[model samples]
Target: MPIDWSPLKEIIDQQNRFVLTSHVRPDADALGSELGMALLLRSLGKTVQIINPGATPAHLQFLDPDGEIKSVHDAPALKQAILECDVHIVLDTSAWGQLGEVGKLMQKSTTQKVVIDHHVSSDDLNAIQFKDTSSPATGCLVYDFTQAIDHTPSARAASCLYAAIATDTGWFRFPSTTSKTMRTIANLIDAGANPAELYTLLYEQAAVPRLHLSGIVLQRVATACHGQLAYTYVTQSDFARSKAHPADTENLVNQCMTIAGIRAAFILVQQPNRKYKVSLRSRVDFDVTPIAEQLGGGGHRQASGAMLPGPKDAALKKLIQLFEEELKKQPPAEKNH
Candidate 1:
C-alpha cells in the first residue's frame, strides 16, 4: 500500500520524544538521513535521539558536528532513550533485520512507527512506510517530507541530506539521478549546504591506509565476459596488511566500472567467519538487482549488493558463474544483417 503521512504527522505533533535509527554498517545515505530527520524533529520541539547498531564511520563524523548520535553498544543508555520516545523513525532501511538484533526492541514497542526509505524492497516493512524507490536517494524523500510539513530544515539537516543524495547517486553520476535531483541539491545548497567542503570531506579526506588499500584492490582487478564484467576480491589478510577498516572499502566497486569496456563491476570483500560482502555496479542498461536477489539480497538495478556465507574462493567462483549466467540472459547485441 502507498503511504499516507497525515496520520504520521498527527502522531508527531502529539509526541514529545522521538527515536531515529538506520541500518547497521550505515553508509552516508543511512547516517545522513537519520541525523537529518533527527535534527528536523528536534527543531519542532520534539526530543529526538539518533541511534544505530554500530559507530559512525570516521569519514562521516562531519555529519554529527555536535556528536549526538548514540550507538547500541551502549544498549543500557540507548534503551533508556528509546523508552522515553513516543515515536520511532527508521530511516534508509525498511526491514528491522537491517537494524541488527537491537532493533527487535523497537519493533516490539507500541510507539508510533514511521519509516522513511527509498529502497524498493522496503515497502513490505511494518510502519507508516514512506518509500519512493523512484527517488534518487532517501535523502530526497526526506527533504520533501520535511518541506511537506512546513518544517524549516536546519543547516545540519540540509547538509546531511545533501551528503545522502550526493553519495547514493554517485555524485549525481548515476542514471537514477535526474534534473529533479539536481534541483533538490540546489535547494539544499540554498538551505546552507557547503558542497566544496562536503566534497573534500567525503573523498579527499581519506587516510593513507585507505589510499594504499585502493591501490591493492585495483592491482588485483579481474575482468570477464570479454571485459563487459569485472570483479575484485579483498581477503581478510589484505585488510590486516594495509591496516584498512572495512568501511574503507566503501565506493571501491565504482573503481572497477571506470574501465571503458566494463559495463558491470563487482567487489567481494571477505568478512569474519569466511563470509563475503558483495557489491555490484552497473552502467547503462544492465540491471544487477536480479543478480543480488538470486543470492538472497536486494537493491537497485544499477547498484545492488549481497552477502555470501562461505570461503572467499568458493564464493568468488559461485559469483563468477552467476555473472556468466546473467550475461548470457542479456539479448545479443543487434548485428547489422
Candidate 2:
C-alpha cells in the first residue's frame, strides 16, 4: 500500500524547526534521503539541519559539498538545536543500533519524531513511521514525499537523490528496481540531475589506494559449499598495507558474486576496533536478512550487513558455518551432466 503522506504534510505544516538524520557510516541512500528531505522542508521555508551519527564517508562528501551535514560529535553546539527542533526525522534506517550516538540523543528529545525508511528490520523509536519495503531505496520514499508536497528538488538535491536511488538499486540493475523507480529517476533528471556527471563523480573518482585495496580483496576471494557461496575478507593490516581507508571496502563483496555458480557472497572487513563488518549479498531465491538480523544488523533480502566480534579467523569461521547451514536448506543444483 502507498504511504499516506497527509499526516507527514500536516506535521510539516505545523512544524518550524527540523533536524534530519540517518544511520552511521552513512551511504548514498542515507545521505541522499537526508539531503532530499532537507531540501523539501527548506522549500517550504522551514528551518532544517542535517546531522548524523558519523561524519559523511570521504567518498560521499561530494553529495554535501557545503559540509552542511555534520557529525553529532563534531557539532557540540547543535545538541540544543537538535533537542529543541519541532520535529526530528530519521531517514533510511529504523534500527536504533544503526543510528549510533545520534540515536542516544534522540531518545531524550521530547519533540515529535518521524521515521521514513524502506528496510525490513525496525525498532520502536517512538515515532510515526512511513515505510515501504517495496521501495528500492529510501531516496524513493523521499521522492514520494516531494510529490505529496508537489515540490521539485533543486539540481543539487536532485543529484544527491539520483545518486542515492542509483547506487542502492545497483544503478537500476538490482531486482528491487521497478518501473516506478525509473519514473522517479526520470523526474529527478527533469528536475536538473545529470546522471553521467553524478556517475563519474561517484564511481570514476576512486583514489589509487581504493584500487589497491580492491586488488587485495579480490585476491582473497574463495568459494565454498560446492561453489554456491563465495567469500572474502579485508584485514586491518590490508588497509595499512594498501594505504586505503575503510570506506574503500565498499562494493568489494559484489566482486565475489562475479564467480560462476556462486549463489551467495560475503566480505568481512575488519574495523579499527577489531570487529568485522560483514556485508552479505545473494541472487534470487536466497535471503541474507535472516543472517544479518541474527547478528543484530539488517537490510534488504539481497543485501544485508552485520558486525561480528572478531579474531578475524573466528569471525570467518562463524560466517562460513552460517552460510553453509543456510545453503543446506536450499534444494541442490542439478548436475550439468
Pick the lDDT winner. 2
TM-score, predicted candidate 1 vs. hidden true structure: 0.84
The candidate maximizing TM-score is 2
Q: How would you encode candidate 2's per-residue C-alpha lDDT over 134-236 as one tens digit per residue?
A: 8999999999989888888998889989999999998999888999999999999999999999899888997899999999889889998888999999998
Model 1 Cα lDDT, one tens digit per residue, 1-337: 4346687778888888888888898889998888788788878888888888888877788888777887877669787677567888888878767887548777666777888888756345568878877888889888887877887677778999999999999899877899989988998999989999999988898789998899899899999887888999898888999999888897689889889878789999998667899999887668888899999998877789999987877888888888888877874466587
TM-score, per-candidate, Cα-based: 0.84, 0.85
Local distance difference test, candidate 2: 0.90
RMSDs, each prediction? 3.5, 3.5
Report clash pairs, candidate 2. Answer: none
TM-score of 2: 0.85
